[model samples]
Every structure is written in structure tokens, then in C-alpha cells.
Target chain A: GIQVEQSPPDLILQEGANSTLRCNFSDSVNNLQWFHQNPWGQLINLFYIPSGTKQNGRLSATTVATERYSLLYISSSQTTDSGVYFCAVPGGAGANSKLTFGKGITLSVRP
Target chain B: DVKVTQSSRYLVKRTGEKVFLECVQDMDHENMFWYRQDPGLGLRLIYFSYDVKMKEKGDIPEGYSVSREKKERFSLILESASTNQTSMYLCASRVMGGGFPEAFFGQGTRLTVV
Candidate 1:
């Protein structure tokens, strides 16, 4: 089993601020994903980056698989960005690779 | 859009009652999973199915069981609910592939056992 840890357990930011969240895993992973759990408790897919970088609007993520770490960046944040951000990876190899999730970083973007 | 639907948004049940949480996916994904989320413990997998009639236990599957009678449906059954079982349950679906595709999740069912 792989262990995933997310940093900055809690964060508070004003609208228009920028912040970065990080996730570190204990072992090599074939899958890495970033998710946003909004206030309404819907887990929204942000990026499926096992390696390299990807951007979607104001959100972007980079995963350095070689380093076993990933970063999620939020720029010009808005109140709507307030919620918990999670990073996940499969537990191990083979057909039973169920995803294991980090505790998540709670972000509060105040207006 | 891809969607994983859970049957309930909130539920209240007695401690010894049997409880069933239903999940369905529209994308015809090969993998479906059930997870419970607590305040600080994050999302812990309870059970998962890679195909119809196939299932596997996850990290914390002690008091839970699952059934996958059809490809699109997966059900989590609590033999006898307990106060400790009260938490947010999430259902997710994903395609079976080497790359490990992103999983689509349901809005989550918040259950309380009294």
C-alpha cells in the first residue's frame, strides 16, 4: 500500500490571491489525480496528471512522478474555490488498484 | 457528462438496522468503488467491483459488504449499522486501463446512525 500525504492541512486566502497545495506519496504510482470537493460535497475532477503539467482555467497541477510529489496551483482565486482539495493514487499494481486518497487540504477563499 | 449517482443525499437509521447504499454509473465504466469519508481520516475505501458479479474489499471493509449484480449498479450493504458507521459515503466509477483513468464520483450520501 502507498501512503499519500497532503501539506498545509488548512489554508485561508482572500479573493484574487494565489496558493499552492502539495501531495507526496511513498511509492511509485501509475495514477495520480487532483480533485476538488466543493462546499456542496461534490468531488470535482481537476486533473489526471500522473506526470508533467496540466492547466484548466484558473487551476493547474504538476506531478513529478520521479520525485513522488505533485503540486496543485490556484491563481487569482475566487470565493467559489473554497473547499477541500484532494490528491489520490492507486493502492498498488495489477487489476485491484483501488485508489487511495490523501486527507486533503482545506482552502477557504474569502470574499 | 460522466456521472456516478448515489441513491440518497442523507439518511438516518437505527443502530441495529440494515442499511443499503446504492450507486449507479452512466459511463459504462468497468470499475466501481465505495468509500467512506470522515472528518480527518479522508476517504477510505470500503469495497470495489471491477465487473459484474466481481467484488473486492478495501482498506476498511470490516462491517461492510458489497454486491454488483449488474454492470451499472453496485450496492454497499451494512449488515447491522452502528453509530461508528455514520459518515459520508462516496461512490466512484472508472474505466479499466493501464493508465488508470480518472474516477467520476457521486455527490456522496451522509448517513447518521442513532
Candidate 2:
């Protein structure tokens, strides 16, 4: 089983601020994904980056598979971005599609 | 976009009662999973089904069981619900392929057992 650890368990940011959230894994992963659980408890899919870098609007993510680490960057954060940011890696295999998730980073964007 | 619809947004059940949480995915994905999220335990997989009529136990499957009779639906059943089983349950579906297959989640169901 792979282990996922997220840094800065709690975070607070003002509007228009930028922040970087980090995730470190213990083993090689075939899949890596970032998720945002909004205040309404809807788990929104942020990014599915197994390797390399990708940017979506003001949010970007980079996964260095070789180093077993990933970083999620939020630029000019808004109040709507306040939620629990989670990074998940591979868990089960063969026919099972599972993800092993970290404890998650709680982001608070103040007005 | 993939849509995973859960049966209930919130449910309250009494102890020793049988509970069923239904999940349906519109994309016809082969892999469907049920996970329980707690305060400190993060998200723990309870069960998953890769194909019709096939199921596999996940990390926390002691008080949970799953059924996948149809390709698009996966149901988690608690034969005899207990107080400790109260938690947030999430359903997800994913495609099976060679590359990076992303898993899509539902809007979670918060269950309270008394």
C-alpha cells in the first residue's frame, strides 16, 4: 500500500493571494489526482496528473513522478476556493480502481 | 462530464436496521467504488466492483458489503447498522484503460445512525 502525506495541514489566505500545497508519496504511482471538496461537500475533480505539469484556469499542478511528489498551486485565490484540497495516489490494481488519499490540506481564503 | 449520482444527501437510520446506499454512474464505467470519510481517518475504501456481478473488499469492509448487478449501479449494504457506522460515504466511478484514468466522485451521503 502507498502512503500519501499532505503538507501544512491547515492554511489561511486572503483574497488575491497565491499558495502552494504539496503532496508526498512513499512509492511509485501510476495515477495521481487532485480534488477539491467544496463547502457543500461536493468533491470536485481538480486535476489528474500522473506526471508532468498542467494548468487549469488559475489552478495548476505538477507531478514529478520520479521523485514521488506533487504540488498544487493556486494563484490569486478567491473565497470560492476555500475548501479541503486532497491529493490521491494509486491504491488497488488489476480490476479495481482505487485511490489512496492523504489527510488533505484545509485552505481558507478570507475576504 | 462524468456524473455520479448518489441516492441520498443525508440519511438517518436506527441501529440494527438494514441500510442501503445506492450509486449510479451515467458513463457506464466498469470500476465503481464506495469509500467512507472520517474526521481523522481520511477516505478509506470500503468496496469496489470492476464488472457486473463482481465485487472486491477494500481497506474498511468489515461493516459494509456491495452489490453490482447492473453495469451502471453499485449499492452498499449494511446488514445490521451500528452507531459506529455513522460517517460520510462517497461513491466514485472510473474507466479502465492503459493511461491515466481519472475517478469521478458523487456529492457524498452523510449518514447518522442512532
- Candidate that would win on DockQ: 1
Best by lDDT: 1
Off by over 4 Å in 1: none
Per-residue alpha-carbon lDDT of candidate 2 for residues A1-111, written as tens digits (9 for 90 to 100): 888999989999999999999999998887799999988777999999989999999999999999999999999999999999999987745446578899999999999
Fnat per model, in the order shown: 0.72, 0.58
- What's the C-alpha lDDT at position B80 in model 2? 96
| Model 1, span A1-111: residue lDDT tens | 799999999999999999999999999998799999988788999999989999999999999999999999999999999999999998878755899999999999999
Error of 1 at B85 (Å): 0.7
Encode model 2's per-residue lDDT on B2-108: one tens digit a residue.
99999999999999999999999999899899999998788999998889999989998998888999999999999999999999999999987655489999999
Relative to the real complex, the DockQ score for model 2 comes to: 0.65
Q: State interface RMSD in Å for all models.
A: 1.1, 1.9
Pairs of residues at least 3 apart in sequence or in different chains that clash in candidate 1: none
Candidate 2: C-alpha RMSD to true structure equals: 1.1
lDDT for residue B64 in candidate 1, whole number 0-100: 94
Worst 10 residues of 1 chain B by lDDT: B95-104
True interface contacts retained by model 2: 0.58
